[model samples]
Target: MNGRKNVVEVLIFKKEVEADPRFNVIGEVSLEDTDMLDHIGEGIDVKLIPI
Candidate 1:
């Protein structure tokens, strides 16, 4: 993180885990929201908000 621009990625985990820098896990989604993961495709529009 030495002045590098941050990157965001989406991962579908079959197991739960604590955040790890090696995996770049900034956060996670709820179980109910997992359904949306199946719909990701070429035109996906994503936005990140720092709540």
Candidate 2:
């Protein structure tokens, strides 16, 4: 069997809400992991939309 790694990467950035609004609104995006995971894939624009 060919072995492959199912890996995911994450990067955390700290910034003022004015510098990056997305950082301030992560908590309001969604409560489900699927909702977050859906946005974190290849070619997907990773961002947290303020509700």
Candidate 3:
């Protein structure tokens, strides 16, 4: 339990595949309050990395 990570839900869609896939991505992401604001201002795209 000490080393376990949390899980997050993400939607993945492939053009070839008619239906989207719902998957779980596990990890932690750290964003400071100010950094989050900056990301919004800069229009940064964030996606989950499979682990």
Judging by TM-score against the true structure, name the best candidate: 1
Q: Pick the candidate with the highest lDDT.
A: 1
In model 3, the runs with Cα more than 4 Å from the true position are 16-51
User: Model 3 over residues 2-44: C-alpha lDDT tens digits?
Assistant: 9987754443221134432553434334434334434442334
Number of the candidate with higher lDDT, 2 or 3: 2
Candidate 1: give the clashing pairs: none
Error of 2 at 40 (Å): 20
| lDDT values for all models | 0.67, 0.46, 0.42
Q: What is model 3's C-alpha RMSD?
A: 11.8
Model 2 lDDT tens row, 11-47: 4333224455544433533345544554455556565
> Cα lDDT for residue 18, model 1?
80
Off by over 4 Å in 2: 14-51
TM-score of each: 0.43, 0.23, 0.23
**Arrange candidates by lDDT, highest first: which order?**
1, 2, 3
Sliding window of 10 residues with minimal summed lDDT for model 1: 6-15
